[model samples]
Target: MIRIVLADDQAVVRDGLSMLLGAADDLDVVATASDGSAAVDAVVRWTPDVALVDLRMPGLDGAQVTAEVGRQAPDVRVLILTTYADDDAVLPALRAGAAGYLTKDTTGEALCSAIRTVAAGGSVLDAAVQQRLVALVGPPVPAPEPDIPDGLTTREVDTLRLVAQGLSNQQVATRLVVSEATVKTHVNHLISKLAVDGRPALVAWAWRHGVVH
Candidate 1:
């Protein structure tokens, strides 16, 4: 089972998400916190496999919790579960070593999938959020091939195509018969070459320019 920690200030949201997620057979909501500081405490105490944190909590906030988790509980994967999906918060969260991010508007199934994805050592940034990052960083360059994108290794392109299709890293790894770490390297490389700062950007650029076929 995937062990998880929930950290959002809203009682209704926390309760709803906890109930929804806990119902999944493969998931376990090991602990819940109302804010960032409590999230940190939960990490130190419970050491769950995944932490779903809100970006705007009192005291510590999502980014700070992510950073602390990175330092103090290196084994734990942090996934930002927030309402905002703009660059102002995205960069800091990623820089803090958050493995993935998703909007609070995400469906419960999607949110559960994101937690599992992060726990399995894969990225789970929402596609819309990814586009926002690209807009903030710079304009996306149209791929030369339209159909035949470049800059990434052929394998990297394949990995990105799967990502665009909304497959998790674990799913991609299983499909490709490669390790998840290898898929992650391909993803990072794809992000660098496309100048698409995040998953949403990649999806937008690929759809607009026809990179994935």
Candidate 2:
């Protein structure tokens, strides 16, 4: 079963989300929070597989809760739930290590599926969110980008592009015709050179600076 914790200042929203998720056979709404700090505390205590968060909560907010949870328990993936998809909320949420973002209006089915996807180490970039990522990232400019970093081989660049295209680690290895271990090595090297900690950062960096193109 996928354990979940929900954090939203609004009681109605929390109740709705909890009921929606609880109806799923494979999902358990272990707890719910009315504030960001409580969300952070619950995440550390229960260590849910995923957290559904509201970006505008009074204390700490979604970004801070996500960051704190990531620092204290990185295994608990964060999924931001906001009323709007604006950059004001989206970019900061992603930077804080949230695995996905969803608006309040999403269907029960979609929300449940997103939880499953994020729990399995995948992001749910809604169509609007995908465009937001590209827009906020600006554009590609390869010139003078990280010196192509000393350790990255030509094959690694191909691999990086695939990653920027949203492929999982296993998918990257298969696409590059190499073992997962090889892909892990390349990815580790890339992160060290670029100084990024997660896929969202790597993707934004590669897309914005033309590193992967």
Top-scoring candidate (lDDT): 2
Model 1 accuracy (lDDT, Cα):
0.81
| Candidate 2 residue lDDT tens string, 84-167 | 776577888888889888877788898898889889877665646655776786766657654355667888777778877767
lDDT digits (tens) for residues 1-213 of candidate 1? 999999999999899989998899999999999988999999889999999999889999899999999899999999997787874777788768888888888888888877877888777878777666556656545666655454557787778778876687778889999998898788777778878646555655565555553
lDDT of 1 at 54: 90
Task: Sum up the clashes in candidate 1.
Answer: 4
* Candidate 2: segments with Cα more than 4 A from true spot: 104-110, 122-124, 142-150, 173-184, 211-213
Superpose all Cα atoms of candidate 1 onto the true structure and report the RMSD in Å to 1 decimal.
3.8
**Cα TM-score per model:** 0.78, 0.78
Worst 10 residues of 1 by lDDT: 204-213
